[model samples]
Target chain A: MRVDYRPRRVSSAIAVLAAAGSVAALATVSEQYLAVGISLAGVLVLAFGAAVYRRGLRVLGVPIALVGVAVGFAGFGVGVSLVGVYDRSFTYTGELIGLLGLPFIALGVLPVHRRLSRRLVSLGFAFLVLGVVFTGAVNGTGPDPIPLLLGIVAAIVAWDAGEQAINLGDQLGSDARTWPAELSHSGGTAVFGGLSVGTGLVMFNADITGLPLESLLLLLGAALVLMVALYK
Target chain B: MSNATADTTTKARATNTDAATDADAATDAEVETATSSSYGQRVSTDADGDDLVVEGERRRTGRWRGIVAVALFASAVGVLANTPFLLLATVPVAAYAAYPRLTGSPSATLAVERVIDDDTPDRGDDVEVTVRITNTGRWPLTDVRFVDGVPPMLAVREGSPRHATFLWPGTTTEFSYTVGAEYGRHQFDPVTALLRDVSGGTELEAEVDCDPATVLTCTDAVPEVPLRKQTRHSTGRLVTDDGGAGIEFHRTREYQKGDPMSRIDWKRYAKTGQLTTVEFREERAATIVLLVDARPSAYRASAEGEPHGLAYNLAGAEQLLTALGETRDYVGLAAIGREFCWLAAGVGLEHELTARELLATHPVLSTVPPDEDPTDPDEQAAELRKRLSGDAQVVLLSPLGDEYITSLALSLEASGHPVTVVSPDVTSDATVGSRLAGVDRENRISSLRQAEIPVVDWTVDEPLGTTIVNSTEVMD
Candidate 1:
């Protein structure tokens, strides 16, 4: 089957999402010092994504996208500060927004069809979610569990759908017979996503405080078996 | 009565002119008398006009929409959740999406022009080509990148064909490059241009039609060629065959009725009571047909950075044509390609010109040689045999890289036509495959020589003229 591999676009899309999630999480942080470090990481991720997407420009694309993103963040930050409404959250968010440039830079420089880039993108999003959850816990006034769960579910679905779309487009580009393959692939991904969301909801609601160690071990074994079955 | 007839013809001609004048008077009086003559001249020359073919169009490659949409969604979510950080992501995406929309389509107003230093260069001459791109629209083009479509036959000698620049309205940007001319008629391809906005989101790709009239016609001059010593019975520069009325003495014979008085031996008459006649060998011209193997397999070069075998064959053919022309012999040309190409044997200025033009521009003699022959070897040979004169000799020019060429030569020799192979060596010992090919080629040449067909195994490193001369000396 013909497959048109476009790793750059897919990686860039994931990076954009991760940077956005990082900015949203950093906006609520009270400690300015911690926000600065997190914001810089977000900016780096955005720059990497920008670089990856503009790979045709070669080494030149990396610097162009990174510098453009940095300049954009600085300009926005300065404009907001002039308006007298700049705060620790706004500064941190601006810095995190700078992270959107990472994808552009990554897209420009990274080679296509690399599994590592995809894995890194997924990990980046995971880190963003964990950071948000950690911030909420430290504040002692966390977001509602249901909305946060829905958001996470939405994020996962978007990411999976984007990946599938890229794959489908690539197959079509290569003139491959994609209808049957795409249909089954999409169905499988949807089922996995639904099961994960359902399990997360169940775990959140279930009262495990009084459960015995033996029973907990039994639940862990059952979960492992379910995961294996799902994998196959 | 003859005077009356002449007067009658003159009157009729005058009346015809008057009739033409009456017809002209019926039309607009402003029409000049020279118009009719000029129109006739134009109609005669219009048969060979240049053709302009435009290919490719501007199309949008939507690469950035998905990312923009995802960024927008994230920003909306951030606004709803009172998170300023998510809104920051919307800034870059919005700018990227809006940037392309700000600049309307520039392809409609873009004009490309190609200029070459020499359109009709000799073979091996370097030609400089300059491509100019101008924006005719009112809006300035923020980013532009273009790659010139250089002909495949020619290789770039200096500079690159690709360039990137930004142009303002009514401004022009150009890039120049040089390419080495090869033997063929090369038509320039259209230049491909890609224009993008400041945000690098949307791209408009277009194939710009440049100078369609720009063409390079590279021709080789005839070089000194060497031929074999063997000659047939015909009137030519080669002295051959039995005794006749010629310079060198053959034998004395008894005087016959048709014997001229000058040929009678007066010394023999004084010595004995007998009349003898003197005879000399007759000199006859060779009828030769130069055959070039343009098959796909014969298109290989000796190494990575060398010209292909077909180029060498053409040079050899040109040389042979010159040699045969000097001898005032009947010479023709044939190329074995997808289709069998033949030029009839003749002797004249027009014939030489036609042969040279065919060698330089025939579709069978493409710069980027074809890989396979459409017709089988047997069919091609039959076609070649049909066009060949009965006693005409064949000089086969090939790389001998493939076995089929050897078979073709042997078959022609077997068919009563004396065949001489002038094979250009296009194999090297640098690599194993090349080494094997070189050995195989050597075997083919040796086998042909064993069959008594004169084979000139010309090496690529040696000059063609020197090789031909050495081979002829060896044959002698």
Candidate 2:
């Protein structure tokens, strides 16, 4: 009767795909197909580990996660290629794939340690966002903006859905039928992501290239005030 | 409002501030008084007679704090890097941060009722429990998570006690689970409900007291109890040392003038030309007292979600009492726990009924472990020794968790009473401390055996009756 909090199938799918999307964005900017292949493979292997862990088989799950992490580290070693297109070219973007290994390992352990896995998942998402920014800003060639924005949005949605799944597992055990709540939560996150992209598109169309620094500062201050008002 | 609080407090019969205050805001005092008057004060006023609602503490889980921090970080990075794509990501993050705040806190206006399929089930039968919850409030509960309080003594065999769903205003939701019934009566506790807003923010927690206080009573008579050779002068099942007229064989003696012809050993007489009479072992009743260990230390369970040691000990006592009742032997019950309990040994249908009833419902033998060790163990033992008759044999049902129980068994054996120890093994190897405890329990069991007490080592995995039968056979 161990209550397992391993992310369900839907949440696990979102997290893996968003993580891959992050790596793919890096690959799209740098033309590194090898890194994308290696990262996606790591994601697939981690999925297997999550499945094995859910079946209460820790003996097999641990080794599978260890192998997946080893593969991911190999990718990390290969992804750190210097291009020096922007002010800083020290791209640790390879860690976007490597960092997820910890969470994948946490996902398979019995009585899934909620706090530790949560921290690891957030840490992996942070690495993904940091890598996306670095890969977009420092590409020797002109970086594509569409994939970069999609990658960032995907990262946030992935974290949201994964966290929701963990909580669902905690509150209602694995034996419970919890798809309705999980699906609705994930759907909400996906819709929110779409709205964000639309907002970004609208701001892009407004031609902010000619705006002055003083106006940008004033806009930021107004936005801060609005946030404070809404918070209350 | 004060009137409502006072009424709710009286009905609940518990010193809970949350139930009192929460009832005051939503329910009127006059309506509450009318409901209490009609229902006789046990049922809550918010819903039907079955449901009792008490508000619980509220706290933020802070699940989305990382998203907020990510949004701030992305916005700072985007403004410096002049990247609008990164800046766009901050919009969704900020929305996530605001979503929970915009959603109103869910109210604790829910009516819950639990229905047990069979109130009196046979041992090992699966008893189904269905719970129905209705949203009695004006607003819908977007995310309602609840766990039914399945009795600890019963193991859930089918489905889950936990559920998460949404219920609109005046709508109902249902979930059911089945538990395998064991011996004795098991009472269900309150249902714990956690209500979260649509955005999974602002949780309202409460305990719903569902009536009519479902209790599952499972009883099965044990066919035989292996008692020691000690016996009373009364005719009963136990074979005694004194030779008389019985089915089993004993030694032969020289024939007397009044000896019956059927009892004469004709073959022996022909071999030695001697008149001899055959003597058979006598059958007599045994006065047996069942002592249960209900001390707090005996409440340990081997694993999570399993019944504790005292639960198994009591169950064993029930089986023994039922088996011993069918025979001519006199059976009595006693407990060493928070409160002292004793029923004098007697033999009859009425006495059997009273002993069984007390064994099932006595406060000292309650399924819930006591809060503290109020009585001195030595003093309780002395009291028990004073109450027991000189010819009575003691059958001690314990877990042998500590050395004190082993000493109790030894002292009883030393006091001229034939003692038999029925120990339920509840120690596990889940941790270093638990493993060490298991070893310690093993040492105590071996020491009791060394003192010549017949120890029935009952493992939880096997049936208690089978274990008892097998162990007693080995002892013979």
Candidate 3:
């Protein structure tokens, strides 16, 4: 009775797809060849780490994937020197390469740790928020909101799907036939992401130029309501 | 050994095409509850039969915590930075956080039926267990996860017992796994279902009983168990000290006038003037009692998947019964466990069947270890001694894992009943604790042997018959 608790195939597929989509969207918005190259290298390292993990060195593989994340972040720092930090495109590139590392970090922690802790997922999510804050630091009319918005949604989906995959892995193990549950969860997240993008696009196009405070307060109130709903 | 017949009455009816259509028609009138109003309540109160038992409260699995944190963080950052895009992304994350509250806990109206390929398998044979789960509720169960309760004695050889899947109403799902069977009667436990609502947020735990209550009975043909030299007065095979009319010669004496002609020593009469009568050893039946030590300590095993020491003890006890049954000897069975089990010394076909059934199904000789210490060993010994016939020899089957059993054997031998010990060795050098336990057990066996008890030190890896034969030679 060998117990193998590796994440299922479908959820992992959805995670990688969502992560790659996020990186591609950010790279295209940034319009930098260096951003694409750095993101590709990060993804390749992540793939290598995943292969190593599949070979049964589960403990060793997580650190290797985490190293890949470190390399991606380090690559972004080095790119900032060559590409210039003040420009809006440089910030987008930084955000792109940084966001590219999120899924691997999620993948690295999920199967190996086997606890119900949310630290790893939260860490990746925090990185997404930090990237958005960094992009806003440049503040040059929000860098064509559509791709940026889609990139954010995709990153969130990637983390959510990764967490769900690991949850299934803990409960059922990798050998169980968990495709239906995994696919259903991923499908629900994708649908919500699509609807969010649609609603976000509509709001962007509405073009109400005044009353920014009211809008901000309204968003904060909605967030407070959601939090209360969850706790209740 | 026999297969317990699968009870077809407990099997859920397979929904046919007509039934599916009727269910579909009934679906429209039954307001679709894929939403928040039915979140906490059991959806199918109308479901009859009450086979599935749902227990425990709605436990929050904390699966949505990360997503909710992300939603809150994104909203806070977006509001402060005035970035509408990041704020917009919060909408979807918030939706996911709310998804759990918007869904109802599945009815958990699942019918679980298990079918064993071979209910009465031979020792060490692979037995396949197929489990079929059918959703009899109206709503589709989106995130159904369960792990079948495999018998503790059997180890799974192929496939996994854990499964997660979605089941639509009237649909059935099946999964099968193989387990290597061991000696004894093993009953499968109920399947544990961890049912989560459509969103993996809220979970309801339940136990689902399988139809037929699958039980695997694996038994071996009785092996030869050699007894001590003690014997009863009845005529049988064991040679006793008293000289009488038998095949083996004992001595010669002066012939009496009334002695039968066949008993007279003709050769001695021809050699000498004085006539002598030849005396032979008397053969008589021995009454034997097989006592199994099934205390908690005897439930130890050398390895994780190996059968425990008590299992070996029960096997040895069964062998002794069958072997003694073949002779004219009166044989009985007894065990010291959670309960004291005893059968009076008897010799008949019906008695043998009763003894065998007791070995197979007695709670005292259960395959699983008792949670608490059994009743006092002294009390059980007194009860056993009271029941044993005066001339009956006791064959004690024990693992000799602890001091109490060794003391018990010595006490029985100290009494009028001659005792022979068959100790099954389940010790290994796998860990420091196991090694120490092995040393302790070795000391116990040596101390028992010091009391002049004929002990068969049977290593579990080999057949008990060979060990008994080897020990019998040593005893002789």
Q: Give lDDT tens digits, candidate 3, residues A1-232.
A: 7666766667766765676566566554343446545644665576677678878887887677777666655555555555564555556555655453554444444443555324555565566555654553344255476666666777777777777777787778777888888787777667767876787677667763235868778757877885887777
Candidate 3: list runs displaced more than 4 Å: A21-86, A97-174, A188-232, B1-60, B66-68, B82-88, B112-129, B146-155, B178-193, B202-209, B213-222, B226-301, B304-426, B452-458
Candidate 3's TM-score reads 0.70
Candidate of highest DockQ: 3
User: In model 1, how large is the Cα lDDT of residue A97?
Assistant: 36
Superposed Cα deviation of residue A8, candidate 2 (Å): 2.8
Q: Which digits, one per residue and each the tens of the lDDT, describe model 1 over residues B192-254?
A: 666655333345666665422246766534344444445556677766656786788888989
DockQ (CA atoms), all models? 0.03, 0.28, 0.44
Rank candidates by DockQ, best first. 3, 2, 1
Better of 2 and 3 by TM-score: 3
Candidate 2: chain B TM-score against the reference chain B: 0.67
Best by TM-score: 3
The lDDT for every candidate, in the order shown, is: 0.56, 0.70, 0.70
Residue lDDT tens for model 1, A33-76: 23333444444544564556555655765665556456534533
Chain A TM-score by candidate, in order: 0.46, 0.77, 0.74
